[model samples]
Target: MGSIKPAKSLLYLAISMVIGGTLLNVNELAYLAVFPLILLAMGLFVEPPSGIKIERIVEEKTYIPGDEVTIRVKVMIERGMGMVLLRQPLPPEVELVKGNNAWSLFKGPRKLEKELTFSIKVPRRGLYTLPPAELYIEPLLKLGKPGTAFLGNPVTITVLPLIKPPRRVRTTNTRSQIPIPLTSYSLTGPISTDFKEIRDYRPGDPVKFINWKATARRGNVLVNEYEREGKKTVMFYVDARPTMSVGTFQENPLEHAVSLVASLAYYFLRRGYNVGLYIVGRGELMMPSTGNRQLYAMVKKLMEVEVLSSANEDFKDAMRKSERIIIQYTPLIIVVSNLLQANELREAFRLLMKHYKGRVPSIVFDLFPYSMFSGKKVELVRLRKIAIERELKAISHVVHWDIRKTEISAVLAKTIRMVR
Candidate 1:
C-alpha cells in the first residue's frame, strides 16, 4: 500500500525523538515526537471508501474496417473519495481517433458520479475485446497509500471487412454464348421452361419455339413465351497463403482479395443467387449457402484471415477437397489467386475440369504482384512480372483476368461479358 512507507517513517521518527529527548532531557523533542505518533495512528485506522461502481457502454457491437467506435465509461462513487486515476487499455487493432483513454480525477469533499467518452478507429477487420477499466483510489490521509480496483466488464466487438459495392455481373448459362440482362429473368421477361402465353413472333425468334396452333389461329407468326429461369449458384475461392501478404496494408494482395470476395459475395447474394465461399488460408474454411446471412458469415471469416509463414497448404489438396461440395451445388466457380506459379494454376484448372467435366463455367482472377509492390525492389518485381507472364501464357485456354488496371467490379463485369 502507498501509505505503508510514510506511516513506517513517521513511527520510526517518533521512536527516535522519544529516546533522544529522554537521554538529553529535551522536552521540546518529546513534544514534537507526539505529532508523528498521532499521524501514524490516524493513517493506520483510515478506511477506503466502499460502494464504488463503474459502468461501461459501447455504442455498437459490430463495425466495418476504418469505422470510428464510441465508448462511454461512467464512474459512480457512493461516498466522498480522494484522487482517482482511471485507465482502459485499448486493443492494438484499433487507433485512438479522439479523446484520452486514461484520465485522473481529483475528487473534492463531495460524492462523485462522472462519465467519460472516447472514440477509436478500427484499423483492420477482426474480433476484439476491450479490457476492463482500472481505478486506483488514493486514500484521504496523505500518509495512506492508494488501492487499485478493476471496473467495468469486458466487451466484444466484431469488425467486418471493408466492402466495396461491386458492379453487377450478369449471369449466363453454361452453354449460352449470349449475355442476358438480369431484368430479363424477372416477371417481365421470359422464364425458362415455364410457359406464360403466346405472343407475335419477333425477328431472331427461334423457329423451334414457334407454336403451330397459335400461329394458325392468329394467322400470323406467333411464338410461345415462358418465364425466366431461377437463380444460379456461385462459389468463390480466396487464396490467402503467405504469398498474399506482400505489400503494405493499402495495397496488400490479401487485403485486396478480402475486399474482392466481400464485394462479389454481396453482389451475387443480393441478386438472389446461391453464394458459397472456400478460403485457402492458414486452414480451409467453407461456407456453402446463400442470402444475406451467408454473406455476413463469409465476410466474418475473411476478416479474421491472417497470413501464416509456416503454412504450406497445397492448392491442389484444397481444390480436391472442395470438388465434392462444388459438384453437389453445381456453382459457377470464381478463383481469386495471385497466380505466382504456373503449377498452381495448372493444378487448380485440373481439379475444376475433373469435377465439372468441362461443362461448368469458371473464372480466375490473377492478382498481379507488380501492382502490390509498385516502385520498390525493381529487380524482384521484374522477375515476378516475367514469371506471371509465363504462367499466363501457359494457361491461355482458361478464362483468366488481370485485375491490376481496373477496379474489382469492372474486372468482374468483363469476366461476365466474356463468359456470356
Candidate 2:
C-alpha cells in the first residue's frame, strides 16, 4: 500500500492561523487557516506512489581488475507520483566512468517507467554487492511528507585479478633472454615445440613430425622429438599475516602475493597439472585439481584475500595441518610471503621436510615492497632484504622479487628454471 503522511510544516501553519484568528476576532484569518487545514485533510486521504519496482542488469557479473562495467537500472511504478528519485550506493573500490548512477525527475500521477544507464571501473579484485536502488517520492502539492522505499534487489559482481604475461629480467653482461623450459613426461602427454632432437624415423610415428631438412642431409627419414610435458601437483602457500601488509593497499606485499599465486595457478592448470592452494593465515584450502574450473575456483578464493592485522597464523602449524594432503599430492611446494624472521622460516621448512621421503622441491618467493620507502630508505631496505634472502636460500630456493623491478611470472619462471 502507498505510504503518505501529512506535512508537519503545513500542520503547524494551520494551527498558527487558527490561534491568530480566534485571538484577533478576524474572519479573514479563519478563512486563511482553511487553506492549510484543507491541504492537511487531503494529505490524510492521499497515498504515495504504489506498485514501485526496480531491476538491475549488469553487463557482466564477473570482471577482471581495472576493467569497466556497464550497469542498467530500470524503474517502474504502476501509478501516482510527484517527484521520483532512484539512487543506489556503489562499492568503494568502484569509480564512475560514463553516466550518473542516481536519477531524479518530476513525474505526474500516472504510470512511470525509466531506464537509467551508467558505467563504472573496478580498481581492485573482490566480490562486491551493489546495494538496492532507493526510491523516494514527494507529494506534488507539498500536502504530504516525502516517502522512501528500497527498490531493487542487491546485485553481486566478482572482480577477478588480472593475469599478466611473464616478463624477462635484464642482465648486466648478457643480451640473451633466459630460456624457460616446461618439462613434460610420458609418451602420450602434450609436446612442446622446443625440439629436443631429430632422430631416425620410427615406425608408427606421426608423419607431421618428419624433419625434411634432416632427412635431406642424412638421406634418410628423420622425426623431430619435442619435450613432452608431464603432470604434477603444485600447492601454493600465500601468507596472510600482518607483515605482508607492508606498503600501500594498492601496491603491497600481500597484493603481489595473491596475484602471484593466481598467475602461477593459471600457468600450471593450463599445463595439465593439478593445483592446490593454502592461504597461510586464513587456513583456506582448495584440494589439488586440474582445468579452468580449478583456476576459477583458485582465483575466487584469491579475490577474497585481504591483509588482516590480527591473524597470527603460525607457518609451521599451517604446514603441519596440511601434511596429509602434501604427502598425497607430492606437489612442488610454492611459498609466497615476506621475510618474517629467518629462524621462523627454517622451522616451517623443517616441518615440511618431515613429511616427504626426500627433499621436496620447494620455492619461496620473497616480495620486496619498494613502495614502502623513498630515496633514503631504499639502500637500507635493500641491504636488509638481501640478508633475509640469503638466509632463506639455505632452506628453500629463494626468488627475490622487487615489486618495481620484476614481474611475478618472470620471477616464478626464474625460480622454476633454477629448480629444473
Candidate 3:
C-alpha cells in the first residue's frame, strides 16, 4: 500500500476537531461534519508528480590526466507537485562540493520546477560511468519521507593516456639511409648473387677469379664478379630495466624510449631494413618481422612491457639466435639502453664483435640524466653519474643523451658525433 499522510492530516484534523467539537457542543453539528470531510478529502486527493526530465553534459568526451574537466547535470520538472526532491548520483571516484551528496529539493504549488548543476574534477585516466538521478515526491501529508524513482540514461567519459615529453631520452645508434633500388644480390657465403656463372675468360677478364675448365673450352680465362646486397638488417635491443626510471609518476622515461623505438622501427621498416626489437624484460620477446603487422606487435608489446632490474637468460639466448640467423647478413647492430653494468656491456659487445670478426660495428645508447644531476646541487651524485657515462663511452661506441636538456630529436641529431 502507498504511504499515508497520517501526521499532516492528523494535525489539521485535530485543530478542526477542537473547533468542531466546541461548536458541536453548542449544537453546531454542520461545521463539525464539514471539518472532518475536508481533512479526509485532502488525504485522499493528493496526486503524485510525474513528467520529470534529467540530462547530463560533459565538457569533453576525451581527457588526459591532470586536465580540468567539468560535468553539468540539468534536471527539469514538467509537472508541478506538493514537494519534490531530486537526488543526482555521481560516479564514486568523483568528489562533490564540500563532501555533500548531489541532491536538490523543490517545494511549491503545482507546476513548480527547477534545474541544478554539479561539476567535478576528473581524477585519473580511465573510462567513467555516470549514474542516473533519483526523483522523489510526496503529496499532502508528510507522515513519511518522499517516494523515489530513478531516471536518466547512463553516460560515459573516456580519459585518454597521458602524453608528455621525456626529461631524459635516449636515441638509438643506427643511422639509416635509403638504399638504391638495384637488384641487390647476397654478397657473403653461398648466396645467389655472390656466385656468377663460370664463363670463358675474355681478353679483359681478371686473372684472380678465372675458371680453368671454362677457360679450356673457350681457350680464355673467365672472371667472377661478386654482387653486393643492398639490404641491411638492423636489430634494436631495448634495455628496459627498473634502475632506469627517469621521470615522475604518470610520466615515465621508458615511454620516451618506447616512442623512439616505435618511430625508428617505422623508419627502418619503411627503408626496407628488416627491423626487429628485443625488449630485455619478463616474457617479452618481439622477434624480427616486417610491415604494419610487425609494427603493431612492437607497439603493443611496448604498451604493456614492465621494467625489471634483470631480464631472463632466455632473452640473451634469443639475441644469440638472431645473431646466428643474420651472421653473414647483418652489418649493423643497435642496442638502446641505459648502460649500467660494465661486464654486461663488455660481454654483449664481445659476442657481436666475435660474429663480425671485428668488422661489424655496434652502437650502445646510454639513456640517463647526466646533465641535471651534474651541477653543484648534488656534486657527488653528478660525479658518479659522469664517471659511469664516461666508463660506458670508453668501453663501447656509446651515445650519451641528457633527456632533461633536449628532446629525442635533438639527441638523435647529435648521435653522428659519437660515431665520428
Candidate 4:
C-alpha cells in the first residue's frame, strides 16, 4: 500500500480552534473568521512530491555451498522532500548479517541517490531468490501522516554442489599389472645379469660363484646372481563395473578410481613401458597403449566415467584375453576394482594366469570393506552380500581399499604407497 497522508487542513483546524477560542474570549476576535482563514492556508499549500527506484547487482553468478557472495542495492529518489526509509528483503536461506534493520530513514529530504551493498554466504546448493526491498517516505509535517511504500523486483542466485575428495577408498579384487615369473624358458647361456641376492651356494657351484657378504654373515660363501628376460609391458585393468557403486554420494567412487588409473598410466608411459588399460563393467574397452597421447586419452575417459547399473556386463572374457596379451606383448598387469563379486573376481584374475601365453605378474586392488558404503546398520541376513564378500577375498590376493568417508587424495596416496 502507498504511504497514507492526512489532509493538511485537519491539523490547521485543530490549531485554529484553540487559537480562535482563546482570542474570542480574551481579545474579542471572531472565532469563525480565524478558523476559516487558517484552514484555507493549510488546504492551499501542497505536500512535497517524491518518488523512489531500486536496482540490484550481485558479485557472483556461481558458487559452491558455504561460499560467500555480496549483493548491492542502489537506491535512487527524485524530488523527494521528506524522510525516506528503505528496507531490503532477503531470501530465507540468506541471512542479512550486515546493514540496517529492514528500514533506514533518509532525514531532511533532497534528491536522494545511494548504492547500498550487502554480503551473504551460500548455505546450501540450489537456486535462490533475493527478496524485494520496502521503500517508505513521510513528509516533514507535525500532522503525524503515514509514509509511502513500494516492493522491488526479485533477483536469483544459483549455487553448485560440493565436489570433495574422499578420505579413504575401497579397492576391489581385480586383475593388475605386476610382474609374473615364467616357467617354460630355455637357457640361452650362463646367467649374466647383475647380482640380485645370494643364499647358500647351490650344489655344483662354480668356483667364481661365491658371495663375500653372504660368507661373512653365514660363515660360508654364498653366490648372488640374476636371470635375463626381454623387456616387459605394463597394463592397468580398471573394473569400472556396475557392482562397484556400493559407496558414494555426490562424489562417486568411480571418479577417484579413474584418477588412480590415469596416474598409473602416466607413470608407466614415462618409464618407457607400453602402458595399456582395460576398462571392465561399462561395456567399453580401452586396449593398452603407450605415449603421452594415450595417457591423456585415459584421463579423459576417467573424467567422464559414470557409475554403471547393476545389470552392466562383466569383464570375464577380457580377463581371459588378458593372459594372452601379457604373454605375447605384456609382462605386468595391475587390476583395480571394488571386489564385490567373489566368483567373477576370482574367474577374471585366475583366467589371466591360466590362459595367458606366459606367466603374468598381477596385483589386485581390492575395494572391499562394505562397511564404508554407509554409516547405517547393515543387514547380516543378506546371504548374497555375505557370499559375495567371501568370494572376493578368496579368489585372488587383493590390495584392500576403502574410499568411504575419507578424503580421496589422502586415500589414493596411501594406496599408492601400499602398491609400491
Candidate 5:
C-alpha cells in the first residue's frame, strides 16, 4: 500500500531551485519551482490500487501434446489510478502460440479492467498448475510508492495423452487361432443364461436363482450368481513405470503407450463397451462403464498418469482386486507398455494369464524404445526384444511397436487381432 509520501524528482528539483535562489536571491524562479513541488505532494493523497481481482478463462480445451489452447486472462483493478502491470507465469514446457502472458497498461480511476489473451501449446503429459496472477500498480504521477497484490487461485490443466486412430484392416470369415489354454466362467450381471458361482442365499435372492443341486450337496441354501450380454467391458492395464521413460519426455515410450490406451478405450467405448483402466503407478482401477462419461473419466485419469520416479509398483495386487471384474465381464485385456528389459512387465503378463483362465484374449502393445537411444547396446536391445516377444506371444496377441520407426496405428493395422 502507498501509505506514506516519498520525495519524488519534482520535490528534489524544487528543493534545488530554492537553494539556488537563496544563494542568488532570485524569488521568481524559486516560487515557480515551489508550485511543481506542491502538485507532486498532492499525489500522496491518491490511494494505491486495491480490490484487485484476476480471472482466467479457457476456451475449447483440447488437452494433448502439440494441441493449442486459447486462454483469456482478465484483471480488474477497482481502486487506485496508476500504471498497471499484470503477469501470469507459465510452466517452461508450455509454449506461447500467440499474444502475451504479461502486459502493461495505463489505468485511471474507479474499475479499470484489462485482458491479456494468449494461445499456448502444452508439450507433455502431467498436471500443470499456472501460478497466481501478479499485479503491480505504480502511481500515475510517479510521486508515491507502488503497490503489489497477488490473486492466489492457480489454474491447473491436465494434459492427456494423444490418441491416434488405428488403421482398420478388416478380414472376412477368418480368425487367427493361437495356441493357448482356454476356460469359461461367469460372474454377476443381468439377463444371460451363463451361470456364475453358487453361494449361500441372501435375503434378496430370488427363488428362481436357487441352486437346488448345490443346496442338496452342501446341505445349505444356495443361489447362483449370473452373467449377461448386450454389454461388454474392456480393461486396460497401463504400465507406467520409469522404464517407460525411455526416450525424450515428449516422445517417450510411456507417452505413446498412454495414447494407445486412450485410442483403444475410445474405440471400444464408442461401440458401447463398458471400459476400465488400471494405471500401474497408483494401482487404482477405474470401474468399467459405458458412455461419454466413462470415456471422459478414463481420459481424465489418463491425463494425470505419469511415469513414476519409483519402480515399486504393485501389479499383482492391482490385478487381484480386479479379478472379479475380469471374471464378471470376461473382458478383453489390453496391456500397454514398453517390455524391453522390464522384468516387472513379464511378471505382469504371467499374472494376467491366470485370470481370464489363460483365455482372456489379450493384446500387448509392446513398445520398442531401443532405437531412440544412442549407444552400442542398441543392437543388443533389439535382440533381447525378440526373446521377450516369444514370451508374450505365448499368451496374447503382440503388436511390436518401434517408436523410432513407426506409429502405433501402423503396427496395430498390421498385427491387430481384436478379441472383441
Candidate 6:
C-alpha cells in the first residue's frame, strides 16, 4: 500500500477554511473543510501497483576496452495504474556514454508497457557485472508516496585488452626472413652438413663440399648446395612479482610489461618463429608453442595477470627450469622486468649466462618504475634511481624503457636496433 502526503491543494483549502471561519461566518466556510478531508482520504487509501514484468537485454557480452555497449530494458504492466519510475544503476567499471538511465512514465488506460535504453563505455579490461534495475510506483492523483520494486536481472561482461597492430621491424639477419609460403617445420638457415641439391661448381666453391658421385656421372665438377630455412624460436619471460605493481591502476609497471610481452610475441610469431611464454608471478604459466594459436594463448594468460601483495619464488624457479630448454634450442630469450632488486637481477643474469654462455641472443628489458617516483622526496627519488641504474648496469645486455615517457612501438623499435 502506498502512503499519503498532504498535497498543496489540500493545504490551500485548509488555510482558506481557517480564515473564513474566523473572520467571516463560520457556517458558510464549514463546507470547504469537507473538500480537503475527502482528498486526504482518497490519497491515504490508494493501492500500490503490482503485476509488472521487467526484461533486460544487452547488445554484447564481450568487448575490448573503450567499446560501447547498449542495454535495453522493457517493462510491461498487467494493469495500468498511476505513475511509474524506472532506474538502472551502472557498474563502476563503465561510464554512461549516452542516453538517460532513469525513466518516468505515466501509466494511462491506453499504455501498458515502457522501454528504456542506454549506452555505456567500458574504459578498462576485466570482468564486470551490471546491477539490477529498480522500479518505483507513485499513488494516483500525485498525492501519495512512491513504492519501489527491483526490475532487471544482472549481466556480466568480459572486457579484453585493446590490441593494436605492432610496427614492422627489419631483422638484422637476412636469414631470419619469412618464406613466402610457410612450412610445418624447417631449418632456419643453410648448413653445409644438411645438403639439398648439386649444382655446377663455381670458381670459389670449396673442395670439401663437392660431390664426387655427381662429378663422376656428369664429368663436370658439381658442388653440394643447401637451402636456408627461415625458422627461429623465441621465449619471453614476464616478471609478475609484487614489486611490479608499483603505480596507479591507469598506468602500472605490470600492465606495461604485459603489453610489451604481448606485442613481441605477436611480432615474432608473424615472422614464423616458435614463441613460448613463461609468466613469473604467483604461479608459473607456460605456453610453449608457435603460430597464431600460441599467440592467443599468451594473450589470454597475460590478460589474467594481477598484482600480488606478497612475492613468490616463481621467477627464480622459472629461470632455472628454462635453462635446459634455452641451451638446447639456443632460442632468443627476452626477460622483461622492473629489476627492482639487485640480488634478483644478478641471479637471473647469472643463470642465463651459465647455461647459454652468450650463445643465445638474450635481452633484458628493464621496465623503469618512473611513475612510482611521482610525489616522492628528491633525495629518496635520487637514491632509488641510482639503485635501479646500478642493478640494470650489472646485467650484460639490458634495455631500459619508461612506459610513461614513450609508447610501446618505440620500445620495440629500440629492441630491433639492438638486435641488428
lDDT string, candidate 4, 1-420, tens digits: 222234345546656666776866744343455654564444335354366778888866657656777777887777635566777766766655655435465544466777877777766445678777777666544223546666577887876443343332346734322333332221222565655457677888776878786788889768876654433356677776665655543334554466566556665566555566777765555655667787667665665555667535565766665555545554456777765456765666666655443433555666543655443454442344556655554443355555554544554555444333
Give the per-residue lDDT of model 2 (tens digit) for 1-420.
223334667777988888888899987897798898786766666566677888999876558877898888887878664677778889887899999988886666677888889999877788779988877887666555678888777899888876764433444544222112232132345777767878899999899999999899999999998866546677788899888888765678887887778877777787777788888888777888899899888888888888767787877878888887766655677888887467777787787776554455678888888645789677877788789889887767788888877866667667544533
Top model number, lDDT: 2
Better of 2 and 6 by lDDT: 2
Q: Could you tell me the TM-score of candidate 1?
A: 0.72
Question: What clash count goes with each model?
Answer: 7, 4, 7, 41, 0, 1
Better candidate number, 4 or 6, judged by lDDT? 6
Q: Give the TM-score of candidate 6.
A: 0.68
Error of 5 at 45 (Å): 2.4
Ranking by TM-score: 5, 2, 1, 6, 3, 4
Off by over 4 Å in 5: 1-9, 19-28, 109-111, 140-142, 176-230, 314-317, 341-360, 415-417
Off by over 4 Å in 6: 1-47, 55-57, 61-63, 66-70, 139-147, 171-231, 321-330, 352-360, 371-396, 417-420
Q: TM-score, each model?
A: 0.72, 0.72, 0.54, 0.43, 0.79, 0.68
> Which pairs of residues clash in candidate 5, taking residues 3 or more apart in a chain or in different chains?
none
What is candidate 6's lDDT per residue for 164-215, written digit by digit as tens? 5566666656543222122222343446355567889999877988999989
RMSD of each: 8.2, 9.6, 9.1, 13.9, 5.8, 8.5
TM-score for candidate 5: 0.79
RMSD of 3: 9.1
How do the residues 1-420 of candidate 3 rate in per-residue lDDT, one tens digit apiece? 344546455657766767776866854643565666665555566555567777878776556545655666666666534566666666777556433335645544555445455566555445667778777777545434457888888887765444332232345634333121222212353433456466555676557777766767776666665555446555677767765565543445565566566666666566566666777655455556567787667666665565776655433554665665446455455666665556666666556655543434556666665454445755564556567667766545666655666677765544433322
Mark the regions of model 1 whose C-alpha exceeds 4 Å error after superposition.
1-46, 169-231, 249-251, 357-360, 369-376, 379-383, 386-390, 393-420
Quote model 2's TM-score.
0.72
* TM-score computed on alpha carbons, candidate 3: 0.54
lDDT of each: 0.70, 0.75, 0.58, 0.58, 0.74, 0.70
What is the per-residue lDDT of model 5 for residues 1-420, given as tens digits with 9 covering 90 to 100? 343334556677888888888888998877878786776766767766677788998764667778787888887778877787888889888888899888887767668887778988888777778888888878857657777777858888877778775655667835554321122222354557766577789998789999899999999999997654446667788888887888786888888887778887887778777788898866768988889999888888887777887757656666777887876766776777777654655565566666554444767778888886778798888788888888767666777888889967775556444442
Clashes of 6: 1
